[model samples]
Target chain A: MDHSGISVLFEGTNFERLLGGLWVTVKIAAVALIVGLILGIILGVLRTFKNRPLRVLLRLYLEFFRIVPTVVLLFLFYYILPRQLNFNLPGDQLATLVFALWVAAEMSDIVRGALISVPQHQRESGKAIGLNRYQLYRYVLIPQAISLEIPATINLATRVIKTTSLLMLISVMDVINIGQQIIEANNHTHPTGVFWVYGLIFLFYFLIDYPLSWWAKRLEKKRLERANG
Target chain B: MKKKSFTRIIAAVSVFAALLLVLTGCGNAKKSSSQSNNPSSVQQIKKNGTIRIAVFGDLPPYGWVNKDGKRVGYDVTLAHQVAKDLGVKVKFVQVNANNRVDALNSNKVDLVLANFTVTPERKQVIDFAKPYMKVSVGVVSPKNKAITKASQLKGKNLIVTKGTTAENYFTSKQPNVNLLKFDSKTQQFNALKNGRGVALADDNSYLYAWSKDNPSYTVGIKSIGPKSYISPAVKKGNKSLLNWTNKEINKLTKQRFFVKDYNTQLKPYFGKEVKPSDIVLPVK
Candidate 1:
């Protein structure tokens, strides 16, 4: 009614509150991404080793995380599993764990793709120079494979941030939740403020995600040029 | 390259579809997926010297955490009264709408005092006591061109909260109305204010509060569909708690307890926009 709906987001502690919510979202996503990258590389390495049971297990892990929805996994790990396992798992910690696992499964596939894309001759040349398995990975395979993975990984980071929006459903107070809170707090004065509040939220996400996406494209171009050279 | 992108799009669409199904609970993984039949009855609660009552952690007026970070709302004040009458300390378990039924059936809480509306589907699983408040779908629109009847909104865009009685009523009974469904009431009102829809439909109690705040809009259609009541739900067949809650509700209604509760707990948040008799069940 006042036509100052957008001002509501900038009013009082509402802006600061929304920023805090974004901090929570980014903090959780960064932890998950870091952990996912580490586990992903490990699994991607393990994927190369042709062991039957281990392969079967890896396949199952990938499929389980990939196939089952993240929302279900959150419920399973957060609520149901703790009761069955007879232990206490806090909601934020469990949310991070689920997101970490999901990111790991996703990143591992990228790892597999990048590693596979590395020409077989690169391995032969490394071996011809008498590089051991560890040194070969450190110097030749990993360095080359990383270029392909970096852009994809950055893209996945944005995806991870987007998915963390779901954290609030489990009552985790992510950025979206904070927007809702601000709207609720000002529901009386700015009943129409939800439009601007959520619009700001969308802008916050776009601001974070768009730059990373642009950076990813630039990195991909540089990597392709380097590869062709 | 064209064929390859087409396949990828198909894959992405199917995965999205699967997520939609699972998220909407078609996979039988409902928020209230617990199949427990246990309901902590009055005797069990009193013997334990505490009564566990589930309430909303964020829905103000009915139930929500106040500025002091303490849970206090309309339902909460009544919960305190219920516990005091039963002579037991109260434990408030925070629950959203999705988990209220599960919290009760899983024996995590003895009673659910959230602004839970009575529905035939919910009645099959959980036993509802006598209602303490009345509600119906109300549509709010800009004052200049208000939607005064359900027929006026027959073919227009109407915003409603997903999973609410209004959504159910429109989708089932009035199929012609195009619904712009959102997740929360705040969003629904915001959608209407932003001109996404001609009117927004939700519980009349909250709609009145919203209309009062945003004077440019009005609840042109204050009531729609059959009248509904908000009630406490216990696990099915928990006769002791059910009967006790019914009697407790009846006594409170007779003594006009909720009116006082409304004056103190809800009035501040709702302001003068909402009246005690408007929300509280009438003495009969």
Candidate 2:
């Protein structure tokens, strides 16, 4: 209703500040997703090992992270970790670490589900061709598992992007935090600013997440097509 | 079949657009109707038999929600007194520092008593009552890394609550300092305790109270920047309410109401080191 209030986002350094905040969010998400992917693959593969104690321990690790909320984990890592361990870490670094652990847990579950979903005959067929254990996994099982993992991983990446908004709570100058600052600074002059300020935040998040969602959908469709063909 | 599906999609989109327009139109209509009424005038508030005052719900000693879920703090008590003096029922709207002014401007509340510091920039948009309390920016840090002077803050990390005078002051005057701004008092203190910054700058009362509770930290710099007064703000051009509130503040000041407020609400938290006389504005 108040175009003037919304116009402030376009004026002066406000838009630039918002973009800087967005960059911070993107950087955090990107780092977390990459690190989590690597760690998750290891954990997922380890869980599939024949060692019973190791599998049980990995299961506990996954369940612990999956059960606790991200915000709680953030607080635990940011607040409790430093005092308990006598080591200081920046809030953004702590947030990324916590998010990565969370992603690792979720990704492990996705990988494990995909690995188990592969047909037993497929692995046997790879071995029938005289492929070694590692070669069988590389040439046969992993390729098939990757097709199953791609869409879910993209969906998880979107979740990481959405979760970066919580970084504002711990004083990380992410996009949502900067949006709050802009609204706080101008709200006195613009009474109707809450609507437009928050609306812009919604738009920024959608612009980022919507494409990821679309890509996930496209990947899923392609997987379906390949399966049919 | 393809044409029929295309027609269905078009019809669905049009219906969704119409629904969105109707919803937004209803919201605009309600806002306009409330604006037209303008029930913030003193006489109108009296006629309506109720006054809504916005105060911070998280900033302890100033305004906070008690464990019992009732609003109990210095500003809340003062707001209740104001309503009682006007023979009107009081409704307390909880607001954070960022949204307090907007709460008044948007007519969501008739008055804001959320430890709002009076400044020229804010004066352009909202009208402040006569000063009720005065406070200066103070700095707190770990005793081992105490910073007594402004010069020490150079290249040092300082934590400040966003939208506060401390943030604005350091941003303009001490641009070289790394200022970490948080949204609430709790987060600012958490950042300080978590070793996010070397010093935390905020209102003297808040820093004083916090340092008193946490022995590891001390108030290194007692004052920074010019003294600012905390006053209740009304929407700009609300002459009737502005005049009435100013008169009420003056009357209450003479009664030493703030002295009682300081003793009851703040003394327990800030300790005996913080004097009531030093912070409460003199009656004028």
Q: Against the unseen true structure, what C-alpha lDDT does each candidate score?
A: 0.80, 0.80
Tens-digit per-residue lDDT, B134-241, candidate 2: 899899989998889989989989999998879988999889999998999779989999999999999888778778768788888877888998899998889899
Q: Ten-residue segment with the worst summed lDDT in candidate 1 chain A? A: A81-90
Q: Write the per-residue lDDT of candidate 1 for residues B1-284, one digit (tens) a residue.
A: 54356446544754774486355443333322343323276877787799988887667778764433456778999899999999999987666778777655545578989999898999998999999988888888999998888899888999999988889989999999999999986688778878999999888887777676677888888788878989999988899899999999999999999999989887775556467877888888
Against the true structure, whose DockQ is highest? Answer: 1
Misplaced by over 4 Å in model 2 are: A1-3, B1-284
Point to the candidate with the largest TM-score.
1
Docking category of candidate 2:
incorrect
DockQ class, candidate 1: incorrect
The superposed Cα distance between candidate 1 and the true structure at residue A59, in angstroms, equals 2.4
